[model samples]
Target: MVVRRRAAPPERCRPSPYGLRPGWDWTARAADAFGRAWHLADRYPYRGTEFDSSFVGIFRVDAADLFSAAPDLVNPAWAEATGQQLQDMVPSYDFHRLEQLPQVLVEAARESGALPAVRDGQMRTARVCGLRAWLHGYRRDQAGSLIPVDAVRWDGGVHHALSVTDDSTDAELAAAARRAEQDAAARGIKLIGASRWVEQLRAARRTAVREQLAGLRDEIAALEDRLKPARKRRTVLVTRILGWDGERDTDTALGRDAGLSHTAVRTLRTALEADQEDRGGEEGGPLAGLFR
Candidate 1:
C-alpha cells in the first residue's frame, strides 16, 4: 500500500495597509511572489550554500506588501549576507507606481502577446532591460487587455538591469562598461563568464603544489640515501670510542680523524653510555666498565 503525502498549504498573503489592488487572486499573487523570491535568491549577492538555511522564508513579503511603501524584510537571508536589513538601507520603496509606468505597460502588452514581443526575430526580454520596472509572465484577458502576472520592480536608485552600448564616445562607452561590470560585481553576478577559468586556475595551482611537494619528498629521500653511509660510519666510530681505553688526546685524535667535532664526539659517547645504563649495561657490554 502506498501512502500519499499531503501537499503543503499555500502561502498566506499579508494584508497591505494601502489595501491590495482589486481583481487580483491571492493564490496566484503568492505563487508569483514565490517565483520572484527564487529569482532574488539566484541573483542575491553573497549567497552560496551559506544562505541555504535562510531559504525557507525568503519571500516573507506578500504580493500586496511588496508594492506597499514599507521596506522591511522578514527574511534573515538578506541580513546574513549584507550584515543589515533591507529597510536599514532603503527606508521605503515606490514599487506601487511601477505598474503605472508607460514602459511597463508596453512591456506587459508585448509579454501578453497583445503586441509583438520580438522585432526581426530578436526577443524583447534581451532588448527591453535597464528599465525602472520590468513586467513579465503577462496574460491577455477576454477583453483583450494585457494583465501582468508578475513584475521585477526596483526604485530609481536601483536598476534591475544594466545595458552598455557603443553609441557613446569610446571613453564614455568604456566608462559605461566599467560601471556595468562594477554594478554586476556588487550584486555577485558573473558577467565576464570566468567561473570555469577560475576553477581551472585553482586546479592548476593545486596540481603545481602537489608536484612541488612530490619533488621535495624525492629530493629528501635522495639526500637521506646519501647520508646513510656517513651515519653508519659514525655509529661504528661511537662503538669503537665506547670500548676505547685511551687518553683524552687519543679520543680527540680519533674524533678528528672521523670528521666529528670533539664536543659532538663527547655527546655521542655520553648518549651511548646513558643507553647502556638504561639496559643495565647488559653483562659486560662496552660501557659496563665505565659505568662501574
Candidate 2:
C-alpha cells in the first residue's frame, strides 16, 4: 500500500514580448539601442540602483512611451533618445513589459531637475510612485520572488510600528515615575533624598521589567523548541499514516522538519533509539522503528 508522489513539474519560461521572436533581426537593434541608452544613463548624475544597457531592452520602450505622453514633464534628451532606440529595436513591444520604464524615467527626471519638490514631498512621491511600481511589477513575476518582498515589507512595517509603540510605552512609564516622585515629595520627606528615592524606584521597576522580558524571551524560545519536535513527529506520523513509498526514516523526517543536516538527524535518531531501548519497549513497534 505504498503511495507514490507526483514528480515535480518542469519550470516554465517567463513570457517576454521583447524577447527573441522567430525571423526577427531585433536582437542587434535591441543590443545597440540598449548600449547607447545605458551609457547615456550611466553618465547622468542620478543615484540608486545601477541599471545599464543590459536592462535597456527591458525598460527603454516604456520610457519612450512616457516621453511621448508627457514630453514636457520628463525632458531628458538622452531618455527620449533611449526610448526611440528601444522602439526602433522592438517595434511591437508589450505595454505590460514597459511598466518599469515610467518609474525609471521619473527617477531620472527628478535627478535631472526636471521634477522639483521639497525633500519630504520628493520622498513621499518616490515611495508612492517608484516603490509602488516596483512592487506591482515584482508581484506579477512569480510567487517565490514575491515571498521575500512580503517578508521584508512585513518585517519593516512591524519593526517601525514596534518602535513607535515602545516609545509611547516608555513615555507612559516615565510619567508614572514623575507622579510617584511628586506624591513622595508632598509628604514633606527631604527633597534631597528625592534623587536617591527615584533611583531606587526605577531600579525596582527595571528589575521587574527585566524579569518579565526574560520570561517572554524564554517562552518564545521554548515554543520554538517544541515546534521542532512537533513538526518532526508530524512528518513521521503523516508519512506512516499515508503509507508513503520508499523507506521511512525518522532521522530524515526530523532533519527536514528541524532544518538540520541529515547526518545530525541520523545521530539524533540513534541517540533516541538508545534511550528508548534502555526503557525496555518492544524493539519493532511503531515508535521503535521510528527512532531506528
Candidate 3:
C-alpha cells in the first residue's frame, strides 16, 4: 500500500473575519495543542471565545435580523454566535448609531480596557437603539486585503442594519455582501410576531384545500367516464313517468308498470314518432325509431 502525506494548513495568526474570537491563539502552536480545543461558549459545539459568548448571551438578536443578514450562513447551532455578531449595535458611550459614533466613544472603545477591539476597532456593532443594523466584519476586497467592519445600512443617519462575516476569500466576501443587500431589501416587512406566522399558515392551508378540491373534481370526472359502459348496458325496470293510461296508449302498459300517468305514455309515443320522421328509419311501428 502507498500513502501520500497531507500538508498542514498555514498557521492562522488571525481568525476568519467574524465576531467570535478564540481564548488563545494556541498553547504551543503544535499539532498536539489540546488546550486550543477547550472553552465555555453560549451555544453548544461552543465556538468563538468567552467574550463572544457573553456578548451574544447579553443581547438577544431577533431571528429575522440573522436571517436577513446572511441566511445561508445560519445553522441551528450557529445562530447564537452569528446573531450576536450580526445584531445592530446597542446604545454605547455617546453614539445613537455606530455610523455616527462620536469620536469620544470610538476613542473610548479603542482606548478603554472594558471593550474588546479587533486590530483597530471595537469588536461589536455600533449602537443605535431601536434601529435595524447590519455588520460585515473585516472582509477582503477584489484586491485581496482586509476591509474592516462598517455598518452598510448606516446611510448617513437613521440607524438600520444587518451583519455578515466579511473575513473570507475575496469572492466569498463579495458574494456575502451581495446576498446581504438583496435579502435586506426583499425581506423588509417585519414578519416576526405570532400573528404574522399564523397568517402565513392560514394562507398555506387555504391553498392546500383549493388544490385538494380540484383533485377531487378530477377524480369524480374520471369515475364518471368509467361508468359510461355500465350505464349503456343497464336498463330501468319500471322507472316512473307522469300522465299515463294503459288502456289508451301502447306505451300505457309500460307507463302503468312504471307508475307513469296516461299523458306521459302518449308523450313518449309522440316523441318516438317524431324521432322516426327525423331519422327516416322505420315507416311506423310500436318500436319505431329505436335505433332503427
**What is each predicted model's overall lDDT from 0 to 1?**
0.40, 0.41, 0.36
Report the alpha-carbon TM-score of model 2 versus the true structure: 0.22
List, residue by residue over 176-225, the lDDT tens digit for candidate 2.
Answer: 43454344334432112222333444466667778999999999999999
Candidate 2 vs candidate 3, lDDT winner: 2
Give the per-residue lDDT of model 1 (tens digit) for 31-63: 445555654654454345443234222111223
> How far does residue 169 in candidate 1 sit from its true spot (Å)?
36
Q: How close is candidate 1 to the true structure, as a TM-score?
A: 0.27
What stretches of model 3 exceed 4 Å from their correct place? 1-191, 234-270, 277-292
Find the 10 residues in a row with the least total lDDT in model 3.
Answer: 156-165
Q: Give the C-alpha lDDT of model 3.
A: 0.36
lDDT of 3 at 285: 42
For every model shown, what is its TM-score relative to the native structure?
0.27, 0.22, 0.27
Runs of candidate 1 with Cα error greater than 4 angstroms are 1-217, 248-252, 275-292
Q: Please give the distance, in angstroms, between residue 215's alpha carbon in candidate 1 and its true position after superposition.
A: 2.9
